[model samples]
Target: NSGYQQQPRQQAPQQFNNQNRIQSMNQFDLIPMSYAELFPALIEKYLVQTRASPPVLAKLPW
Candidate 1:
């Protein structure tokens, strides 16, 4: 019974993190490539707004 109780406690944080990861992925998916071409400067603006680091920029295909 105690093991069952602890199981949920451990799973709760993992579930919460998965939810956050999914939400961020969804947000990124919503941004179309056309938008990047339409407003070139907005890409830099977005990176700044999102507080992305130089290492992150290097990883991006753009």
Candidate 2:
């Protein structure tokens, strides 16, 4: 009835060190300003050099 015995204990699985895992973020440059800031400057520069055409009216939705 007691023929089987507990097996000898073994060390737990080895964990990977930080050095082993590849770096997630390797950014080499900083983020520039968003389109909102850049677009206005571009539009202003274009308007100064180019003339605007007549505007077309459109129906408004309620």
Number of the top lDDT candidate:
2
Q: 1-62, model 2: which lDDT tens digit per residue?
A: 22333333445555568678332433344225544554577788885354688776696555
- Runs of candidate 1 with Cα error greater than 4 angstroms are 1-29, 34-39, 43-62
lDDT of 1: 0.38
Query: Residues 1-62, candidate 1, lDDT per residue (tens digit)?
Result: 12211111122222346346422221122333344353566656675344545554546676
Worst 10 residues of 1 by lDDT: 1-10
CA error at residue 58 for candidate 1, angstroms: 21
Instruction: Report every candidate's CA lDDT.
Output: 0.38, 0.52
Rate residue 7 of model 2 by lDDT: 36
Worst 10 residues of 2 by lDDT: 22-31
Model 2 regions more than 4 Å off: 1-31, 47-62
